[model samples]
Target: MEQIQRSNWKFNMILLGMVLLLIVSIIYSITLGSADISMKDVYQILFAKITGNNALLEGFEKGWIDIVWLIRLPRILLAVFAGIALSLSGAVMQAIVNNPLADPYILGISSGASLGATLAILLGVGISFGPNYVGISAFIGALSVSFLVLLFGSSSSRADVSRLLLVGIALSSLCSAISSIIVFAANNRNGMMTLNFWLLGSLSAANWQIVKILAPIVIVISIFFCFQSRILNLMLVGDEAAVTLGQENHIYRIVYIILAAILIGFIVYACGIIGFVGLVVPHIARLLVGVNHKRMIPITILFGGLFLLWADILSRMIIKGVEIPIGVIVSIVGAPFFLYLVIQNSGERRQ
Candidate 1:
């Protein structure tokens, strides 16, 4: 009991530290970008907005107010939520599939979303959904592919890891081929450029509307997963062991995959396909928390938020005037870390 208490205390401390770090990171990140704003003014504006005291805005310029409240805050909040959603989903995917390399995009969801967005941009498909129709189309496409993967991957025996991965790869290749055909056939160069940018990912489209839609979904789903931590832990032990423990791993796996697909669809719709946070952040969290979902989930969420927040900052500041795509930035960082993980895992196996 005393040891359990000590462990709980340590966990609480880590949680507290991460929350504080996130707050600081958000404040610091808001101060970056093309427009110059000091830390003091940033806090003042935030304080005024929170307290509903117009007096605090007395000396602050209107443009600064718009920049801080309208532009940067939404973008930062989106980054925070997106990071949480993607990382949480990634961790869940790895557990469900029993693969260390599994990520939210591993099921071809991102490629499907890209294809939907490509068609929407190049051929004006799904325009009836209004201005954000591309996002809606992408969501539909992602969800569709997720269901297809499950359907095709399942067999009379079971939906094993190898079968699921094979289905995902096959679907991914098909989607990529269709997307290439659309890109080549399109007459509008500008539309193709826009589609390309969206494919690479950007948080520049971040706005209050998106934050409103994304935050609750991420928070609620994350809380739900926390309740399923025991099952997730069981899944890591493989299907046979999970069955012996009176848990049906296949059913839970399907549920988790569908939920993960929903999360990925929303994320792709909101911010396109920002990768690596889902893949890398969970692994990093496991290193610190030892693969227990209860501990790893919250830590992964916090670390993912912090990671992408900084990545977004770098995306803006990397070039003199051009913003690098967040996807590109994440890939640049994630690929090397992935290689290191592969090497480490291989060494462990040899030992």
Candidate 2:
């Protein structure tokens, strides 16, 4: 009992630290925009906006207020949701596939989304969905591929990770080929530029409307997966062993994959396919808290949120007035870190 109590206390402390880190990181994200807003002003603006109280910023200038409320706040909120969604889904995907290399986009979901958005931009196919048509198209692409992967991978008597991965690769290649044909045929520079930006990813167009669409989808999926930690742990131990322990690994595997796809689709719709937060944050969480899903899930979410918030800031401020693509920044940083992790893990496996 004493040992259990001690363990519980340590877990609680880590949770507390993570909460603080999130709060600090959120404030840091708000404070470090291009216009040089102070931390106190950010706090007052946020509090006043949330509470519907103008008294919080009675003396502030109108321009500063507009910058905080109209511009930066929505962008930051989008980043928060995108980060949480990506990181949590990554952790869940790692568990679903029982592979450290697994990410939410592993099964070509990102490629599918890219294809959809590219086609929509270059060909104007999803114009019926209004200004947000590209995002909707991307979501559809991701979900379609996700369902197909599950359908093909689960027709057998057993669940096969490699089979699902192969299906994803094939489908992704098809999507890529289709998208490439459209891009090549369309001789319009503006359309090609729009497609390229969608592929690179950014939060410049983020708004309160997009936040409204993203929040509920990501929150519901994240909460649902959090409770499935037990099943996820069973998955990590393999299907045969899970069946021996009275767990239906194949059923849970399909469910997890679908759930991951939904989350990934929503994220791609929200942020245009930001990578690495899913792949990188989970590994760091696993290092800190072992392979336990319950603890790692939330930690991964918080740290992922923090990581992307800073990444967004860097993307915006790294080159003065010009904004860098968030995807490019993440890839640049994440590739080196991923290589290091690969080397370290290889050494460990050798040992």
Candidate 3:
């Protein structure tokens, strides 16, 4: 009874922390943008909008209102959902593969999506899909490559994690070659420019319409994965042990991969191919709370959301009045941090 009560208390505390972070992040995201809006006006506008109480509203600037309410808010929400989806997928991937380095983009999903988007832009394929045809094409490509990787990776008598990694790398290289060919062949200025920006990733395109589409996909997936901590724990124990315990890791492996692929595809489509969130967030979560999935999953998602929120903010404000690609920001920071973690871990192991 004591243990159960303790667990409940811990869970409640974590939930409270998450709620506080969300509220604080929303406020910060709303108040700080390219166009400055005072916190007072920000709260008044939000309060009046929510409660229909215009008593506090008096001659506020419309431009700031539009920037905060219409533009920056949606982008921040998208970043939150994207962060959650990527980190959840990353944590689950690490469990499924039983590898510390496993991430959502490890299995060629980003490359495939990038190839699809490149094709759509350079070759004008899938133009009939509407305004966001590139995103649609990219998602289809990601899902397709993911399915192929599973099929090839599972072709052996035993589902080996090494086989999956090798197959994923090969497929990723193939997609990259194809994308390069298209870019070179097209030789069009606008197509190349569009492809470059898309590859680097951005949340500048966020809107309510995008939120409506991506929210359910990401939120539902993240919630479902949280309940899967038990299965994930078993997966970390190796396949032989899992079989002895009468738990089929292969089936769970495929399911996790498919779900991760879908979430990753949507992210790639929505924000281009932002890298390292999956790799970095899960490692940080593991370091903080050990390898236990119950604690790791939620913490990873929350940390990932916060990390990307700040990354997005910096991407916008790093060079006054100029937006930097988020991918570049993540790569710059993640590379050094990853190196430091490797050295520190190696030293500790030697010690």
- Listed in order, each prediction's TM-score against the native is 0.91, 0.88, 0.87
Candidate 1 yields a Cα-based lDDT of: 0.84
- How many backbone clashes are present in model 1? 0
Kindly list the per-residue Cα lDDT of model 3 for residues 109-191, writing each as its tens digit. Answer: 77888888888878888999998797788877887887777678764455566677788789988997888778878887776
Q: Which candidate number maximizes lDDT? A: 1
lDDT of each: 0.84, 0.79, 0.80
Give the Å shift of residue 107 in candidate 1: 3.0
Q: Give the range of the ten consecutive residues with the poorest summed lDDT in model 1.
A: 153-162
Q: Candidate 2's residue-wise lDDT over 1-351, tens digit each?
A: 998898678777877898898787777677776687788887898899889998888989888888888878788888888888888878877787676765656667777777777777777878999987977788778777777766776546654677876777788778767776787789778766666665788888787888888888888887887787898889899888988999887677667766777677667766776877788999988887778888888788778877888889889888998899898998898778767867886899899
Stretches of candidate 2 exceeding 4 Å from the true structure: 1-3, 55-61, 126-133, 150-159, 162-174, 344-351
Clashing pairs in 3: none
Better of 1 and 2 by lDDT: 1
Provide the lDDT at 106 for model 2: 60
Q: Predictions ranked by TM-score, top down?
A: 1, 2, 3
lDDT of 2 at 190: 74
